[model samples]
Target chain A: MSSSSNGNGTPILELSDVHTYYGSIHALKGISIEVHDGEIVTLLGANGAGKSTTLRSINGLNRPRQGKISFQGRDITTVAAHEIVKRGIAQSPEGRRLFPRMSVIENLEMGAFQRSDRSEIRGDMDRVFELFPRLHERRNQKAGTMSGGEQQMCAIGRALMARPKLLLLDEPSLGLAPIFVERIFDIIKQINDQGTSILLVEQNALMALDAADRGYVLETGRIVLADKAAALKTNEQVRKTYLGET
Target chain B: MAADASVPTLANRLQRPSVVGLLGVVVVGGAAALLLKNLTVAPSRFFEVTLIGLTTGCVYALVALGYTLVYGILELINFAHGDVFMLGGMFTITYSTHFFGLHHGQGPATILIVFATLVLAMLSCGLINATIEFIAYRPLRGAPRLAPLITAIGVSFIIQDIGLAWKGPNYITAPDVFPHSRVFSFHGVDYGWNKLIVVVITIPVLLGLLWLVQQTRQGKAMRATAQDKDAAAIMGINVNRTISFTFLIAGALAGAAGLCYSLYVTTVRFDQGFQLGLIAFTAAVLGGIGNLPGAVLGAVLIGLIQTWNEGLPWHMPGSDWTQSIVFSILILILVFRPEGLLGERTPEGG
Candidate 1:
């Protein structure tokens, strides 16, 4: 995962043999992944496979007990969670963790909390509205009252409000309807195409493969397979396990 | 077809009224009837009592806001908050009389000294509160809920002891500096400058607090932190600092309320904070603990209830029954609508 010859110069985010723990129980064991600039990297895994833990480690919510995580070529392994977001990496965390009582507009405002540019923040908010018009329509509505798919949009929109160079999304399509799942993947690709690198974690293997530039298969706190997205889609092992094939 | 048509009517008749709603209507209607009866009997006395209630309620509202602010963020009851208020009163007395030689009939000088004392008391209490959070509660962040609950009680006792030592277990009195001149007179009912001054000072502080919580960027952070601490942290908000700031604001509020209580009443004691703090805490719960405006409403209502029970010339239970009635209402609110008046009802027990 850390070969470092992607021709995109230095990778925007690089994790080297990171190991994280939850109390005494080991959650992530020697996991390594990378998202280069302008690329969509997907982490494909089943439940309890340490996918969310990997994102937490990168976001500094769960500091890795061992190993190094560098973002834009600076080490962030020991940085505080809030400071991590300030360093230009924002996550639409697992569970979409929107402030339930807050209105959609306020929730989005929280995403851009670290940014100081007032006019640019307004412009970015408008841009997010363009990406998800449903949010603009329900800007005054409480985030908790929205449908699951709408909340997912609000969560991603909130992260975009931070104007991050790297966006970490954990299970954005989880529990969404099939149509919504498709729309979410489309937006993920659209977001990547617009120049922010993405690291996506998902269970919908086929759609993740379709949208991602690269993919990694994780199993029980370990990355079992890593390759180009197109290659992983056709890989026999990934097909039998994560792809739900015979 | 007849049965089907009747079903809609039956459903409409049933509506949303539960036993509790019916009970609420009966209680409110009964209270209104009693109030009307008293008003007709002695309008001047009724108005006088109501004005006193409003003034006292303003002070309670300030303290209640402090409880609600801390509770909203950490879900801790902060039993020590009331004692912090007692400290505020002591600070006010020491700063006003000893430092400024403030006395009655100073006129314009009284206002300046009072304002200076208010600022000093607020600043001292705010720092004390923030320090308490840093030393006492922050370390127990990862501990169970009961751990902090007991710690709050322990902290309350420690503060009470400090107050006891500082004032030597005696009632401390402040200089009665506010003018006794009438602010208004109507139908033989007189509202004094002393009372009007309390309300005037309270309105601006209340408005300032509302603006700070609702409009400022820091206020948004406080709200976000309150609803979800982890989510707030992920949003790049310093959760620890926000909690500390919340304590600071809550303490400052307690300080302001302390000044009002001592100056208006002209007498204070070491043990008064415990009793008044419980009343304010009850008010917070009655109005919905985390909701700011609800705290104010609850405090005012309690104030009115206390005054009317004592002052009104009617078939009332009188002053001796005041505590019983307030606590009874608290019990009723807990049993029927634990969310308080304005609190949103949340699903309990998962």
Candidate 2:
């Protein structure tokens, strides 16, 4: 909620000259970006534009082969995926990877796997319930049985159970109805406003630009443009190329 | 790991409930007739064989549970589980008599010595099971199914070799430590304290395992990890650790079975693991792989069948045909009802 005291505006997450590979194929090529504290930053791209790979690298699922990824002024480029989550970064991964056979309450409990505080964990469960009451209503139902929107809510709620300082959401609007997309975007903004820094990757450029404070455009493993959200919204190339405007 | 069994054709048609319903009636009727005949012809012998079969069946059920637990999570039929059980039995003999200085007629002190041996054997076997998972199976987690499945067989032989080396390829006698006195007599048939002890050990282990899976946090993680490893990882659950923990628990169960078998059966051999392990695996599949209670039920059924085949006086097949009979049951179960007696028939596993 407050600006940096140093006045230099140090980012909470910084990636400098990062490169990642899937075996021999280079997936991320020297991608560099900074996410400042208390701001919703988004990555906009088309298919195979390395947007998901970028998030994966930041979360330590795909380790960078070169350069560094620092989170809160510490190099975490090669940290294990589970350890990264423990260090205060939680991801609602692509496709809303909810544990299908597990109950809604059980899925949320899994999010707080590394945490041991009984009272605080219970309190966060209450907060998640407050944010998504549908989940609370269906707490005992298996997650796979829920509708798509409800499953997405459970996925996000599962992440929030970790009480992370930074949340990385990948394509939260994918495969959702228009109404649900709007609701998901609202939840994203609400989560950010509650003191968590967010870095989102989305293909829905119009919605992402509207919600994000700053947006980065990636094309085939490279960032083609980095601009403030308002500027990116009105840019001629972005409007034509991504927004389906001729 | 579910195979695409989409094309149902004729085989699936034969499995339709309408047809199976008729088959069920005939089978039930025949079984009822057999039971009535056995009861009327030799009532005392019938009671004795049934009691013996149940005791043997419960012990086998313990081993079947180990197989089911690992398969439930990993979908890998750990051929090595049987060897682990064998080694666990070996450890019981070595730890109790050699390490703990246990002897015959030690009075009430026998309980403390037996408890100490059981714990030591369980702890060692649990570590061995975890180590096997870590070293042999963890690396092949993402490989094609056949690779890990073959690896399991190879690991099985390796563990068997270790057992062979330790016990020197012979039938080693388990010390006759269980009290020989009968608990009760029924129609001149005595049920001994030794059989009671096996039940005493097995029931608690099964209960403890059920509580662990149904109630504990770790058990929840295991279910999640089994359902989806990648999703579990994203949720910050250490997928590898959960898997290893599963092996540890399965190993402990095998240890209990080892102790039970050696005491109740009165013998342990280096090669006993494979023969008995096969029976337990059959039991797991009969109950339905990945289902816990199904495994015990399957084991009990198999045990009863084996004892009846060998122990029946009228028209009884000798002990030599026991293997053939058990294998026949396995094939019949696999063909007629592959999902097993207790296994839920999921659409994807068609």
Candidate 3:
């Protein structure tokens, strides 16, 4: 991971020791992470390892009881969830929580809810359609009725409509066919190439490590390993536990 | 947008030979027969009754739309909405009688005063409904579904009591300001200016609301929030504010209904909102609770059914059975198809 001292300046998103709880359960315990201006940072973990929880803390859905979070160097530790999106952060949340009754175009329009520039929104819609041609074909289809891969594509496409500076994607390839998985990863890379930083949470370690520039291995609410994606991919413990290597 | 060919469509489901479906067909067919018989026997009386039904349905549609709007966003029945409608009528009565001293036969001046009263009542009720949401609903949002539902019922009683205190036990009457002159006539059945006035105002408001919800940016936000609050928030939509705005719109609709009922019916009591509210609620449910057009359709259908039963000449159940018939339809709907006529049949726990 590129630190501030390495001439990268302040990271676009920085979390310092964020603690989050789900009632009595300590979901995220003093976890700190960073994503620079144009890098894809992936958080890889087993179930209950707080990977999703960390993203939740950063996005303001699950407010951290302890620690500071900043985007573009502005304090947003206690900001409301909707305000987080207004500050150029958007999430294709877990389970692809698309509005079931709404058509695909309607869902995309919803992504630009905070935006005021009416004419520019159409351009963004076209850009999203360009990215996912499958979505374009099914633009009138209800989000819930689509197949899993299509729904995931729609979810990512919906997030992109926000024109976010930092896109928080939770398991973009959780339940997709192999072909869709590859296509999604390629789009993720293309999205990064266009200058939006990303914080990706994924259980698919191999695919996530491949797409990400830097990788963090989270275990039981704390980040255990933080290194370049290449290095983490070759790490002995990561290979064994996460990659399913016997 | 098309469902897979193998998947049974709504038409197919309706045609499927289930007991509920069979019963529905029989009931609908029987009602159709009765309606046809009544129409053939007394064409002019039927048309007059139909006009009256349509006018009453417009009022119920306004109130039913309120119930549907709140229910669409929050999935809460918002029992107090009827009381809000009641208060709207009271507001209209107060403004027309005391503020404007509006009486019959004032010509164009009366029109201006009535219009002003309509605006004031709508604004007042909208603010009140929003306030009710802020106080009663917002705090219990994270609580279980029953918490908010119970609170809504409680709020309904509170609003009713407030109405009771404001107008006393007696019926608050509005001046007979709406002209009784016939707009059009056929076979001695005159469509009066009062009835025409109700239709003229209602159609525009309903259409405007449809445009707002379907076409506008804020409407998109509202729909997104209704579908999924968390996902909507992630997309930069303010869920709470959207919910509050929904209540505001719903309350405004009830207020308009109140004004119409006061002017056309000319008499509104404090507890009337509760009875009317239930009928409207039933209308909303019948049309498919969360669906906008569905509520209006259900309201109109119920209005027609009520009037037809009372006004028709041949083997009619009459006015005394209106409550029983309406409630029975509600019960049957709940038992057979909770999704209602226009609602999508979402699998339970899906």
Candidate 4:
């Protein structure tokens, strides 16, 4: 956490003293973190740990009651959800949230909703279909009818269609088999390799730590630990609790 | 760039015939059979029925667009929209008869006045519908699907009661401003100018709306929001505003249709929207609830069926059976082709 603020490489996104509440129950409390440009930052925690809240807060879906969220050197704390997206932030929300009744091609088209350049949109669609050939094969098929792994691929492809500088993924590996999980993680790495900074939220700590450059551990609405992924992966407490070590 | 390399595969998939192709075949085949049949029906009666049907169909399409647009975005039934359309016609009649003191066959000036009044009535209906969305529907959003639906029905009954209180269940005679004249004859068929006016006016309005949805930036935003609200919001679309705009447009179309019905038919009442709304709802479902062109096609088909049902001789169905027949056909269509004629199942994660 200390190494996150060297001024040499300014953070792409920063959240300070953030708080969020759902009705009367507090969801995220006094959470602070920084994500540098081009970094793979993973937030790992158990269920109800506020990992999703942190990501949603950035996009203004769940606005923090008190805090500052700065993205690319601009304060986005009070910005509307849709406007936040225009500023080059995109989220592949939990549960995929795909329009189940629309065609695969139509789903991808929606990804570029804010963009006006027709040619660029076409180009982005082409790029997405390339990454997931299954999506290409089923371009006319309804996304809800696809298999879990394929749907996850479509979700990722849909996010990429936005061509965002920062992509937030909430539980991309949920409800997936082991092989599909490995494949999804590989694709995530590939997407990050292509220069899109990522903020991944997952309960699958082992895999997330393996893929992330740095990691944060949250528990009961607070950040309990933050460190380099390599160090966190070997940390005694993390190993015993999250990594299933004997 | 990595994703672009797989274009050939997607192109191949897109080229395959979808459900839309099958529906086209059925519709075309049915229409051809109807045209090809040279029945012994009376020519005069057939012409009259066709004219009436076309006018009725145009009105149905106008009302159905409201259902389709609202359903396209919110997926809500908007049971109250029909009453709103009825109120629009009532308002037009009130203004033309009571306020302006306009009467039947007064000249082209009266025609111009009627048109102006009709436009104002439609605009007012649009504003009312927008207000309804803001006040009633907006609060119930994200609660549950049934909550808004129930609220819509409640609103429908409330409007109906208001109309009953205002007009007292009496049939109001709409002022006939246009001169009653048969404009021309085509192959022994007399063409009335009023019928021509309705078609000419309606065609352009429908085309304009279609263009607005397909060609304009607002149209793109609408489609985007319809497909996925969160994604649209993510892309900088204000979901609430878009939904409100949709309601306004739908309301205006229905209002204009009501005005046209009042002028063309010569009578209007509080309960007119109830029957017309049901017909339009059926048309929307028949064509595909959210598809634009589908609604128009369904309306025209319904119009034709209704006319033929009444006019065709040699043991054809009675007028009394029209509602039952239309609904029965609707059920069949749903059972066999749930997506409607031109509609497709929307994709997930749009």
Per-model TM values vs. the true structure = 0.94, 0.92, 0.95, 0.80
Can you write out model 4's per-residue Cα lDDT over A44-115, one digit (the tens) per residue? Answer: 888899988898789988889999999999999999998898888888888787766557887787777777
lDDT of 3 by residue, B143-223 (tens): 999999999999999999998888899987888887788999978799999999999889998999999999887788888
- Candidate rank order under TM-score: 3, 1, 2, 4
Q: After TM-score superposition, what is the CA distance of residue A48 in candidate 3 from its true location, in Å?
A: 1.9
Candidate 1 residue B83 C-alpha distance from true site, Å: 1.0
Best by TM-score, which number? 3
Query: Against the true two-chain complex, what DockQ does each candidate achieve?
Result: 0.50, 0.44, 0.60, 0.30
Please report how far candidate 1 places residue A92 from its true position, in Å: 0.8
Residue B3 C-alpha lDDT in model 4: 19
- List residue ranges in candidate 2 displaced over 4 A: A1-8, B1-29, B186-188, B316-318, B332-338, B344-350
Candidate 2: give the clashing pairs.
none
lDDT of 2 by residue, B72-174 (tens): 8888888889988998899999998898887778888888988888888888889999999999999998788888789888988888888888888778887
Error of 4 at A230 (Å): 1.3
Alpha-carbon deviation at A104 in model 3, angstroms: 2.1
lDDT of 3 by residue, A147-189 (tens): 9999998999889988899999999998899898999988998
- lDDT string for model 1 (B277-339, tens) is 999999999998899999999999999998999999999889899988889889988776677
**Interface RMSD after interface superposition, each candidate:** 10.4, 3.3, 3.6, 7.3
Q: Candidate 4: deviation at residue B342, Å?
A: 4.3
Fnat for every candidate: 0.68, 0.53, 0.77, 0.58
Model 2 residue B127 lDDT score: 92
Across A56-120, the per-residue lDDT of candidate 2 in tens digits comes to: 89888788999999998999988888788888999898988887767899889989988889779
Q: What is the lDDT of candidate 3?
A: 0.89
